[model samples]
Target: MTTRQNSSADQESAAVVILGAGPAGLTLGNLLHAHGIDCVVLERSDRAALGARARAGFLAANTVRTLERHGLADGLRRHGRPHGVCEFRTDGGRFRLDYGSLGRRELHTVYPQQDLVADLLTHYLDAGGRISFGTEALAVHDADGVRPVVAARDAHGRPARWQARYVAGCDGRHGAARRSLPPTALRHQCDHGVSWLGLLAEAPPSLDAVGYATHRSGFAGHMARTPEVTRYYLQCERGTPADAWTDEQVWDRLDLRMRAADHGPLRRGRILRRTVVDLSSDVVEPLRHGSLLLAGDAASLISPSAAKGANLAVLEAELLAEALVGDLAHGDATALERYSRRCLAHIWRAQEFSRWMIRLLHAAPGTDGESFFHESLRRSRLDSLRTSRAHQDWFAENYVGV
Candidate 1:
């Protein structure tokens, strides 16, 4: 591990300062390092914590390409599995879509995010990249000026300052980057009025394809992580505690909602982790503000319905890295000027598709009349997906393409 430098005595300097060590920050760091750009990654957690944090495992085709282009994808290419089929189940019946056969024939690479992060961390360190783990960025000052200063606290509780030519805010929605945003920034927010209890299980996946089950009780999802691990989601009331249900109760509910009785019993095991995720979406307009730029969850927060978060993060990081290199290395600012517009276009499209997926997989909660109306619309959408090749193609295109 690299020893953190105490900055209280004198301000540290870098060409760029990256906040957070997740996909977006690390990707940006690696790309910038490859281009011989001087940068440092500041992370709030220690190295072990960051390496073990599990997150979205699905990697869009574009994300894979981005990693490959920068020589950061070897780990995933060696360990990740290519997945393309998803199965939907409702009262009507069950059907599967071989999404890889439709549209552009693209497939998602299933690589657990923790593993990917560890890979990126290793590559960055091996290439002599600097990272200050256990450093929490407190705020950004003078972002509107030529040089920005990041106030942070080191793991040993010492105050530190880093002056950088540019700052990349990839620390997430509630990170210091967002907190430092000026009042002039516009934030658009939306709530879908739904919640999901995300679960990680030690058991193997019961089905070969990703499973989406819609029952009167609620919605249940099944996604395989590895041969021994599976991820599941159960629709729950808003504000439900992650530990509201016991492991046995969770399995029973999953079985009922997933119609396992009609199909087959799910392979059960110990619940590894649980969390309640609110189905919400938000976007910050103008991802760039002077010397500070936002990427990943800092720029936009999309529901996990479409598995677009990490994909979008990789995309934004690539774009930002390229634009930064252009401006710093060649003195060209054209790409930097157009970065926000380009990223926003993709963000909006992914948001739309994610919203559509949310509506399709979960029935609205309300009176019987309201439920029936929403259910009808959901059925019609499913019917189109099942019967119309065009609709399936569209779903497949958006499902794997971000």
Candidate 2:
């Protein structure tokens, strides 16, 4: 395996240490590095395959602006597609919410998460940022006099230990850094009881932008990565296996849900990738404890339905970096003290919106007519969102962009 060489001899303890070199960690590192702060990031995987894992692909207008302001948007603009609107379709008809109608600025970007990560990593490396991949952080001791030791083995399976004044747990949900926090800190969690089977393929995009379609059979959402590459998601019951349905079967089902009622081809492509994941939202209070702080997926989760996870993560990292910079400059932790509450103010809003969206689109199990109720509720929400300029503006400001 290929690896980036490290010169740890003169690499004294860094001012800040970041766990997991994902979007959140890298974003925070970039911001801090720009301010002349030293930080070391530990990632469990190697470079060249950072975002190989399946995850969210859409980045909202707010996230786009954040990236652009942070100097990571130049490469993004070169590779991403700006989208104006997103539509919801059902057997009754379709309702489209044109974000452009609500605001003069563009709304969202149809860029894959991997593509965004790749671009950010490239820019980050060129700027002299260092990420130690294939290195695992075994434990975090945040007590006094310890300086928080991060134990791991290097890419060649050599043992390594890193000590830093402060540690940022920007790792994902499953990483040990988040688990290191006391169990009581986890304040809220809500499971939507549904799963989305994501599919990636190199085929002609079916729609001009993002499309949300609902049928009696299920729900299907389509997004274009490029003119030739498309990303798709099909709603399914929790625990459904991808192998249970053949590739042809999956495409046929997608066709049924997304095929235009006007007799238009929804576009078909060969499957490139697929995975299923349960939808859930979680937020841990007081994002900091001792010398450790949680950011991104480690601190909170934005449902895929909301299309805000990556955006929220980016914003969170930005906030944390700002707070850290203030702390370093003024010898005050005021911003750090306010970190969790400030971040939560935005997080809970997204949580509510995402939950509302999940309830609006996903089919309910059993025979309570829950599906019918949700469908009606969705239509009502769409009408209100479209007709009321004030409401639309609120969404455009809060949910869409900077």
Candidate 3:
């Protein structure tokens, strides 16, 4: 936890104090509200910031069902696009997989995370759910004891304490919830030693299917965000600034890596945003720490390679909401005790798939011989995935299941 602000006369209270107002927090808030449980969400960002903070866009089949089941997917059902095919370009050639027909026969709902968050937020507020916007949660005190106290600072810079029976940390990895964990708590992480310059362009998508291009230079990817906007990714140096390359340079590099000459050219437009994302994954063990429970990115940070971060966040939020409901509304604590183990199972599975995706997309970081061998292995893996129905089935199931 960071520096704590002493409690003042303006003390707040809730049955559960949720930190961070992302997918997990807002989803949990809505579920708890429907269940008649008193919970409040504390968010450091304003509502406008949340409505504009774009992230992952691929929502798994399970995620859509979960949101719809809770009466919170009207926006998603109305605007989300169905996507299932992915084209992989390699040294030899390119192959497209119609994953919607394989494995569990599930397809991804391509809805921008910000739009989903906006929908969740709107539904939450409309239902009279309580949330403290622009309120920064500094630390959680007495989480090991009954009734934890969350120290926070409001928009006016006033110190406030929220007392709660339980605390849900939907905040990201660096948030106070992860900081407040005991030193003995276990946090496992893997650095893939690669980075991608994530790009958002104000142009229509260049391809109908999702594109994954593996080149001698690096990996380049293309995904459609909307009818008028597209998302692109270009592998870059580890510490390179997002804006180090001009728009033209970025487009050229993308063209080179994506082999636009052989296939087709990308539609160029104004670059809206550039973000550097390091490929890495981390998991916090025993998600329950006394009265404090971790959820979403706070419990696990999965690389965006497989677009699993937001989906995992939504899944974990549903699980956590159920557990919290069981404990708060009823006298049952069985679900609460089993939360960590169950969620970790799903988290680890997603991590394994993400690692596979990283290896399939990026060459290993090493000298000439090592890199060649690694690239060869990656190609072999892709070849197997392209030709083997069994391999494709596995990929499709894992790709859209979680």
lDDT for each candidate structure: 0.93, 0.77, 0.91
Steric overlap count per candidate: 0, 1, 1
Task: After the best TM-score superposition of candidate 1, give how far the Cα of residue 75 lies from its true spot, in angstroms.
Answer: 0.7
What TM-score, to 2 decimals, does candidate 1 have? 0.97
Itemize residue pairs with steric clashes in candidate 3. Answer: 1-179
Candidate 3 RMSD computed on C-alpha atoms after optimal superposition onto the true structure: 3.1
> Candidate 1: lDDT over CA atoms?
0.93
lDDT of 1 at 158: 94
Please write out the lDDT profile of model 3 over residues 1-402, one tens digit for every residue: 111222346887888889999999999999988998888899999999999998888899999999999999999899999999999988888899999999999999999999999999999999999888989999999899987998999999998889888999999998889988987789999999999999999999998889999988899999989889899999998999998999999999988887899988899999999999998899999899999999999999999999998998989999998998898778789999999999999999999999999999997776799788987888899999999999999999999988
> Highest lDDT: which candidate?
1
Per-prediction TM-score, please?
0.97, 0.91, 0.97
Error of 2 at 390 (Å): 5.0
lDDT for model 3 comes to 0.91
Per-residue error at 275 for model 2, in Å?
A: 1.0
Clashing pairs in 2: 62-401
